[model samples]
Target: MSTLLIKNARNIVTMDGERNVYPGGSLYAEGQRIVAIGYDLPYDKADAVIDAGGKIVYPGMINTHHHLYQNLTRNIPFAQQCGLFDWLLTLYEVWRQLRPEDVYVSAAVGIGELLKSGCTTTSDHFYCFPNGVSGELIDEEIRAAQELGIRFYPTRGSMSLGRSGGGLPPDEVCQDERTILTDTRRVIERYHDADRFSMLRIGVAPCSPFSVTTDLLRESAALARSYGVRMHTHLAETEDEERFCIGRFGLRPLDYMEKHGWIGDDVWFAHGIWFDDGEIARLGHHRCGIAHCPTSNMKLSSGTMPLAKMLKAGVRVGLGVDGSASNDDSNMLLETKIAHLVHRLTDGPTAPGAEDFLKIATVGSARVLGWEDAIGSLEPGKAADLFIIDASKLEFAGALFDDAALPVLTGLSQTVDTTIVGGRIVVMDGALVGVDERKLAESAQAAADRLLGEATFRTKIDYRARRNALSM
Candidate 1:
């Protein structure tokens, strides 16, 4: 029965179907639903009021893919310059040292960063489950997301095939197929709410094509569908992965996955950077989704995703920050900037514009996660999840001419003035509510130090030396 009102002075980027922008706008919310949004409102009545004078409000960015736990393992010197395969090999050695607390703390820190970047909803793909830690890793991530008050779509990611089984991850990090399935079901029953505005939802992800077996993929997708949940996985990310799929499965990545019940609207793949023209058509036909990670793709030299072609081909596309280790940061606004600039460089005039990038992070990403009706844009009866950027800031001075284009063209890499999720203020006045920022940072650093020291895998491989040796 509580009401909150955002009074006006600036612009409101509605991002609705009509692409409306209201000047000197105001919005009112009752509990979790947006009751009204227009140029003016009864500014005198509300339980709480935020004077959004000289600000530009837009739908909060939704992150469709992330490895929140990887926040604890970023900036690793040994793995800094490596590509996908070598990078995973080096990091698996360190990720095996993960404890339950590491998942909790890392997810908290990662979520903190995403909120500051104007992200209100996110799906974390946490597949690394070392021995004795598999039981409660998803629980920890859900707990962190709940505490932070952001809409969470955490995929119950699993890897059932290890190096012993000719997969990429080490033995300790992979789980039995039965265990992964059972845990996925348990989490769905426990945390996955099917209500329209529910905050937490679960998905089934069996890591990547190279890190899991064919049987695991089929079973995970089936389990997810049986529970009325969604399916997620990494597919066709790099050339190396494409080769792996071809050699082992004797088909392209998309073909192999499609045969295993993964080619449908309810399923989405992360780092979808290596599909052919025919495969893109298939994706469009099946209505599958792609979580495009522009920053991670460039960082790993994974090749361009042909985003404009995919969009034109009628395939659903969304934006994700990928893993913290690959992206090195979880900022949706920053991701939007990179996605906008890189696509223009690769796709030319038909590339996505600044407003298009904003839609990708909001409307398109919500479509990928199947939460479009509830979360995406600013409309009546939709969840009140959005962020306000103070247009008066120095960086946004001259860029206010186009409010929709400004966020993507002139990105804000810092914390926003306000971020609201489901009619709740998770962040206000550039600080997180109900969390001790400094203390949590110190805890994350201490935990990272411990994890680095406790890693049994030696960081003995000198990447720079290896490169020099290769040249010789």
Candidate 2:
């Protein structure tokens, strides 16, 4: 049995129940799980001992939502200034050109960015499937996560209704529901690990209300439960979607979701921005989770999510970067920072503080992704997933003088120095291990260039129309 020791020189913010902060603390791990954490632990006998001098260690940030494949199409000029529907319409053509290699490269870039931002575990929603792209898309993402040594949740997302069939995505980008379901099961059978320190998991997500039929959502959720996995989808994102659901389903998004069995502790929806008080109450009652994408919501001009209200109502909420294309940046720390600031702006003086935001980014997100008991804290028997930030950075210089809690320090700006997942170091000194960042960036750009040139893919898109004749 191999063992690793993490000794320190500064502070260790164990985001456990007591939320203890140990000065000059140490953590010990055997295999992939943490064995002990406290001050001045015996660390002489170990395979590896990392001395984190003058830094702050905290639970690694957890990203509950993302579209890793979107990294291949980040900053597309045509979609730079559009709303959700229009943006998807504009990018559908480009996303149609996705190949296995494109997914591979973007997963590298996206996961690398998340690691640098102190996220050790991330869930990626990859729904676009054109030119016969299969679950191999997600396989590539999992492969990248494996090489980087970060915990991964690869949601096998699908769009069953195309523009031709009254959906937002183009015909080429959507897939048959049967094929999607069968492939989802296949991926789960092949990749979903249920072990305590599993490096990978699989979730089933039927893209969104506007892109999938009610049957797909119900069946996907049922299938996920059958395999004991989780469910995820995009819901109540924008006012436009609200109106569309009202007109099409005779109810709002959350009500329609309820009609389709999409509410539960095992299910989470991204961008719960437009839900009403009733809907929020219902989610809390059912224990549904929400993946809060503050930056992406603000970037798309979607309305503010009632985060404080949701929290007050006992909803499970977590922070997410959303998608690389929408966020244009995969930074979980910045997402937490923005979440903290925006919640205060929306909630006035009664708002959540920096500690709340940190919890959402770490433990809260882990719970949203159904990983709470295994990750999200530096507790003994949990996975050794944590990150250390150099508190001496220029952005955080003054805050260290009076900061008592590391979560409080989250409001202060900082960059992560080390990120470890499952007792493995994936990022050290703020750089990705075993990979070339410059080469990854260049390769992503090159793939984006080639994807933009697919004429067949371009012909499949309808930039403004909500539906096309081929929608199922």
Candidate 3:
């Protein structure tokens, strides 16, 4: 077993129950969990050591929701300047041209962006599936996450109701209910891991209230519960979605979901920006979670989420970058900063402090993903999943007093110095380990260009061949 010692950190901000910070700290890890963390803990033999004398350490930020495949279609001009529905409608045609290689490469690009931004774990909601695409799309994403050494929870996201069936997505991109659930079972049986500290888990997510039938949502939730996994979906992100739910189901978005047995602690929804005080109270009462996507909300001109009221009501609130197509990037740190600033502009400057936003990104997000027991905090027996930023860096000048609040307050919009996940170093010295960032960037840009028709796809990728290449 290998061991690593993170010695002499300038500050280790543990997002624990007390929100403790250790000055001149050291953390030791063996295998996949933290062994000790404090000032000058006993440690002799170690496989590697990180000298973090001037660096601030934090529990790796966890992202509660994302759509990784959208990385390939980020910032399309037509889709860029629109509201949620118009944006999705314009992009769905482009997304319908997806290939297996598109999923693989785009997942890598998105997860790599997350790693660079100090996010150790992220949950992605991938729901788009065009006709003729291989059914093993989620498997490709899982393979990408494994290769990149990021903790991933990929939901078996599906869309069954198309425009022909009174849904928002085109018919070609939606699957039948039987096909969706059967693939959900196959992926869960093949990839889902329920063990604590496990790197991969499966979540079942229908696209949204506007895109999937009521029966599919109920069945998907039941199937997820039977497998003892989590459930996720897009919900209440926009007024348009709310109106759609009201017109079709004769209920508000949350009411529609509640009717489908899609409430409680087992489920979390993305872009919960439109919920009112009563709905937030109801969600808090049930311990249902909301993944607040601040950047996407602002970008799409969707109304700001009632962050202050939700927190006051004890709602389980977390942070998400949403998707690259909407947010245009996977920088969780930027998302955190915006989450803080937007609320202050809407609620007050004193609404959510830097520490509160930090917890929401770390512990709060872990809770939403049902991984709180293992990976959220920098404590002994928890996974050694965290990132280190050199506080002495010029960007952090005169901002060292409050390390916990530094990221959100001052806005660290660049890569951290190092990142470790599951006791392994995935990024070092502000660069990714075991990955060629330049080549990945080149390859992904090529794939993105092809997917969006900017660059012709001269090379057709075979999923089996891509899997074989990954095995090497």
Candidate 4:
């Protein structure tokens, strides 16, 4: 029954059906849904009125993929310059020391950073657990998101195949297939909310092709369908993965997934960078989505994804910040900015505009996350989830040109000032509202120190033994 109104916004980019851009716009929300969207509103009767005189408003950015717990292990110096497989190998040892409290604290820090950068809805791919850590790791993260007031989707992610059974991770970091399946069922029973405007939803993810066995993937998909949840995993990320699948399974990554019943509308993959035309067509046929991580791909020297080609082929393309250890940050605005530039380079310049990138960050990502029906656009009948950017911030000053600002949110001027989730203002005037961020940071650093101090964590796993002459 709480009523809020936003009036006199300098600009409003509504990525609704018409894709309207209203200058000096006004909007109102009642309960958790948007009730009105137009210009010059009567704000006198609202319980609260946000006077957005010098700000721009848009649908809140959606993060399609992330490993919020990986914030603790970012920039571990030994892992910085490695390729895809090497990078995971180097970090798995360090990640084995993570605790429940570590997961909680790191999720707080990662989600807080994302909120500051305008991401209001974020999906986490937390697949690593070790040393008797309980499935309550996900519960702890959900509590953290509630404290920060961000819409969260925490997937029950697992890895069932260890090095002893032909997987990438060592035996210590892998879980028994039965235990993983049972815990996934328990979590879904406890937390999978299916209602609109739900603050939390659950997904089922079984790490990736290399870390999980084929039976696990097939079973996970079947279980996800039974529970009506989404499926996510890493696929065709690098040339190494392509070669590994072909050498072991005698099939390309996409074909292997097809054989295992892993391709469909309910599934999405991270980094579809190495997909051939046939594989791309397979994605379109199954209506699968892709979470494009431009910065992580570039940093790891994985080839650029064919985003322009995917869009042309009607593939569902969205943006992801990927894992913190890979991209080292959860800044969604920067991720979209980099994606914009990278797409232009892939198309040989004179390509898409900033507005196109904004769409990917907002609606495109929501579509991938299966939240477009509730939270992706600034339109009546949708959840009133959006963020405001202060045009006066230093990075954005002198960036808004002319009386009519373009539909695009440019890389130079996307500085977030306030973020509202489901009609609740979680951040205002560049400061978080509820939690003491300084306190959260201190706790997170302490947890990171403890994880990094473990004897096994201190040793980096070298994949030199697996490196063949043709690996390069």
Q: For residues 164-199, what per-residue lDDT tens digits would candidate 3 score against the true structure?
A: 989989998999999999999999999888889889
Candidate 4 on 1-472: residue-level lDDT in tens?
9988998898888888778878888999998899888865555578878998988888998999899999998876666768988778777877888788888899999999888888899999878977576756778888889899999988988888888988888888788888889989988888889898999999999988888988898899999999999999988899988988998899999899889888888888999999988778878877888999999999899989988778777778888998888898888888887887787777866666777787888888888888889988899899988888876566655668832133234545444688988889888877788879889889988887677677243564332234333232
> Residue 443 of model 2: what lDDT?
91
- lDDT of every predicted structure (CA atoms): 0.88, 0.84, 0.87, 0.83
The residue-by-residue lDDT of candidate 1 on 184-241, one tens digit each, is: 8889998999899999988999998888888988888888889999999998899999
Stretches of model 2 off by over 4 angstroms after superposition: 402-414, 455-472
Query: Candidate 4, which segments miss by more than 4 Å at Cα?
Result: 402-415, 455-472
What's model 1's lDDT at 351?
Answer: 87
Lowest lDDT block of 10, candidate 1: 463-472
Error of 4 at 411 (Å): 6.6
Overall local distance difference test of candidate 4: 0.83
Instruction: Give one digit per residue, the lDDT tens place, for model 2 in 93-174.
Output: 7787788998899999889989988899999898888857655678888899888888999899999988888888888888
Q: Compared to the true structure, candidate 3 yields what TM-score? A: 0.95
Q: Per-candidate TM vs. native?
A: 0.96, 0.94, 0.95, 0.94
Best by TM-score: 1
Off by over 4 Å in 1: 456-472
Q: Rank candidates by TM-score, best first.
A: 1, 3, 4, 2
Spell out the clash pairs found in candidate 4: 355-408
- Candidate 4, residue 182: how far the Cα is off, in Å: 0.7
